[model samples]
Target chain A: MEFRDAWAIASKDLRIELRSRILTNQIAPYTLLILVLFGFALDADTQTLRDTGPGLFWVAVLLIALLAIQRAVKIEDDDAAKERMLLTPVHSSSVFLGKAIALFIQLFVLEILLFFVMLALFDLSVEDPLLICVSAVLATIGVASSGTLYGVIAAGVGVRETLLPILLLPVLAPIAIGATRTFGDAFGRVDADGWAWFGLLSVFAVVYTVLGMLAYGQLMEDA
Target chain B: MNDVIDLQEAVVTLGQFPALTGVTLKVSQGEIVTVCGPNGAGKSTLLRLCAGLLPLREGSAHILGEDLQKNRRIIRQDVGLLGHRSGLYDDLTVEENVAFWGQMVRAESNEINEAIKLLGLDGRLRKVLVRQLSAGQRRRTSLAGLVVQRPLLWLLDEPHAALDSDGRDLVDGLIHEAAASGATIVLASHAPKDISSPSGRFVTLAGGRVTNDINNDGSGDGVS
Candidate 1:
């Protein structure tokens, strides 16, 4: 029943996003533009871009994740839909899982887009494509879970847009670090242990997912 | 004969200013009660309290046999609250919105369809997005969502606002029908007489408290 409710919510959110085209029309373009500009900032230096591409890719992903989280929270706030949903029999944990699932799907797709863009622009290549995929999935899960939790926490405040980044960015630092190092190993940009960083990413994802499922109900009540 | 709502000296504060102060009221099942008040009289707050959306700062509240302080969240599924906003997703069509909310409450597909038709949201309007809807249509859509829930308690704040004459009549019929079917209703409105049924109770509120609780049975007896 919980999974059913979560799927219902996820499908609802995805449907709305499909209709709105905000992800394709607005946020995607915005993140891609940021990535392109970073290439210019490096003066189109091949070695420089290649060496920094992984970090830059994660940065773009984080920005996109932030926008995605805000958009998720705004949809609920637009018509007091969250409050309305609360009155239903669906559990708040279901709501949290549903939203996180939706976010994960969206962020994963964008990460793929951003990855190919990095490949083309930064002259990047992957030594271990599977590791790259694993890192992306883990990092995306971490972002979605933690971002969903913090999104609701900051939702009730008036200054959420400015406040969200401040609250979300610092917490996402470990993801940025872990995913970057993992990606670096995949790209052969550095010789560090990518699987070790993958371990950290996995822990982050598991911890946040469990915490979100447990705490979402209380956070929503206060939010 | 059981009391569906029993609030005693309930104080609900919104950022330090008490929205509901010392409000004592009792509502039984199968009753249609209209609460009339000026702006900022806590009419909305009272309904929210009964809906278990607001916590009591002082005193006690029990809605549908559940102590609010002990378990407000548990009563939510059985309580329906319609506030000033339509609470319908603008991006979703009328039919989609109704179906979405209905599915949330595990309502049957037939119930969802029936509610849509009952609220006049079938036909072309069913596919129309809520954002494109007029104020009246949106209210009807919201009402359809509420109907699908089939809640034990209906807390409507300004239920007649933004509705046309026919829409208002439709709402009145629904409210009466709901009361007749044993669902307790507490509606707050500015023009209480406009929607007040002959058998309904009229409660006037001011300054976060009830000033008059009177029966419409022509007894002229009021509890102040």
Candidate 2:
């Protein structure tokens, strides 16, 4: 309801992510390394890289984004977080917004790194790098919103480690699928109706963002 | 202005479990009331019900003369809360944490700065990450967060549970300030010994029911 509170809470999370850059930055090199390994493991074939590059890019983004999401939720995992944040004066939705912002920033940075890797490894002269950036941004928003929601629910479960990825896959599988379509359409010789996929991604972002803002007030109280 | 929170024999349930039942209480403007009891006494549940964190399965809950179910956004903004946890990010600076809450409540730009100064957090040392600070500092940030909202109602659950003497003093001072500012406070606490003041009224709960109510006359701090 209060717009001021939402921005402030979101900024708080962003500031923390900046200060603890080590936590979010850990994924960048690993993600890059995976892409490089894919290039080397595939016998340096250009056609194969083009065929699988889009899929590889989205998969790397998902896994890297997962690293940041887990760390963001874990920031409130200890007893001190319960004493401090779960009961603080700020709205619970504010907390979720702040963490989601942190997740988005982390994913955006990874996407940039992937751009360079795509050029260097595959020598893929894809037009409109910024278009992929735009698609990545929308896709990142979806990932952050969904991941944070599930992370909160599974924070205390017995099989939290196993439960998180398994539970998230079905909900987020479409992100990888849709994002790959968008990326391929931006540059590849694909003729599938990618605008519909982009539209679906946008709708997902709006719907989930609304659902999170509304339901989060209840979840934070119990957490 | 009338009763900030009015409950008429309200009952709340979680699925098949009973969290609150047949409970009636009134919180008016400019009042501080403590809900004290052992664990599972539903003291926290009572606070949640007043804050509209749970749906009322029986009776009714009204805030500022409006039904809680119909006017939740208004009531939530009017109510400030701090649960057992510190509810802070160790990585965020004290000022950042304060500013975050300030933004949520749409406080004036100076409100965050003033709260930081009021809490004695002006030095560059205060700009460091919360995780790097001491436990006392974290609690200070958490309390400063409430200052940003300055809500009409403050619902705290065991807010003083893990603090040292200084942290306890900080919380005590904040409560006094909120009460002085005409805020209605309903705080739930299991520990009775920490609170030595004899100003506000104290209500004790046992097995999910209010069993005793008495004014603090400096005669006794323990309700039961």
Candidate 3:
């Protein structure tokens, strides 16, 4: 696939998202709501919240990532639009990569907002900003790649709403663990090995990306 | 003329229900073939099969000189399908939708502009969002995109739906023009009057099989 073709798909999706304001109006606010709900569920204990902030942040991300994937798929809800995309000469893998790239951008922005919210609400402080940033970037790629692959897999089913999370969450569990552990080390909350966790997240990112490219063409037809 | 679409006893199943049962069809290059049938008679399935969207479950299917089973992806690039849906992004303006599809097909900018102009969408409507346009307008935008791609095979499912008399005529003209330029067309429609071109062939499908195959001269065969 030509890189230009993939970027065109990605840019079109991102442009639509920007014009529609779905990400800003609905998804971002939903992520903020999740943080607040987490605060209430944890009983307003700043110490406890701070201790578990990284884990909770990732949890929030995982939940909101579902919304992002759904929105991405929804844009192609008109059957002919998807058929048109499939009929294009661009490789099917390019379509998958394009959507994954768009999702990664949305999630990255959401993470930044959530990170600030955590700092303000949970009184969390970052001890190693660079490490936290790197972990977030790597983990976001992992989430986006797996999320796009599963999103398309469940796109044809009537129970896609219930099925996407079931299919995606288990695949993303390793990402959650690795991201949380690395974030913990970045926050100076644990003496755990940070590079190893970052490495694990990186591996998840690369593996899922490669798998998505190889599997998307078959999935697009089968689904 | 070369055969662009050749399906010999092609069978397609949707779930357990057979949508196309041992269907044989041949469309030559630059020929215009219209499929007429009631709902559930598998007219749409025939178009999808030619576009390589539907898998051939039992028999041979070839389109644009490529075997459907082996070269579906490559065949898709040369084929353009316009189904029931308009396929335009609601959030994007008419121009943007056409430009987006043009980029996907790697069409030249002049060709894109020419297509949009040919569809008569070059005025203020070009800047209007697709969602805000009437159904006829949306259909025109989709046809413009199809025109820009300049596909070898055109599979249109109800190509005249939701269009005014003028828009319908425009579609017919486009079909005739495309066929004159050596582009094969297979369209499904309920209205026979809409596709009354003298050079066109008509095939009626019923119960997943061809019921009537009539030529422009009105001499043909009937299956049942």
Best by DockQ: 1
In model 2 chain A, which range of ten residues has the least summed lDDT?
Answer: A79-88
Tens-digit lDDT track of model 3 for B132-157 = 99988999999999999999999999
- Best-first order by lDDT: 1, 3, 2
DockQ of 2: 0.40
lDDT of 1 by residue, A98-210 (tens): 99999999999898888898999999988999999999999999999999999999998999999999999999999999999999999999889999999999999999999
Q: What share of the true interface contacts does each candidate keep?
A: 0.70, 0.54, 0.72
Models ranked on DockQ: 1, 3, 2
Score every model by TM-score.
0.99, 0.80, 0.98
Model 3's lDDT to the true fold?
0.90
Q: Write the per-residue lDDT of candidate 3 for residues A151-175, one digit (tens) a residue.
A: 9999888788899999999999999
Question: What DockQ, on C-alphas, does every prediction get?
Answer: 0.82, 0.40, 0.75
What Cα-based lDDT does every candidate model obtain? 0.93, 0.73, 0.90
Please tell me what DockQ candidate 3 reaches: 0.75
Which candidate do you rate higher for lDDT, 1 or 2?
1
Cα deviation of A181, candidate 2, in Å: 4.3
The better-scoring model by DockQ among 2 and 3 is 3
Ten contiguous residues with the weakest lDDT in model 3 chain A: A77-86
> Where does model 3 sit among the CAPRI classes?
medium
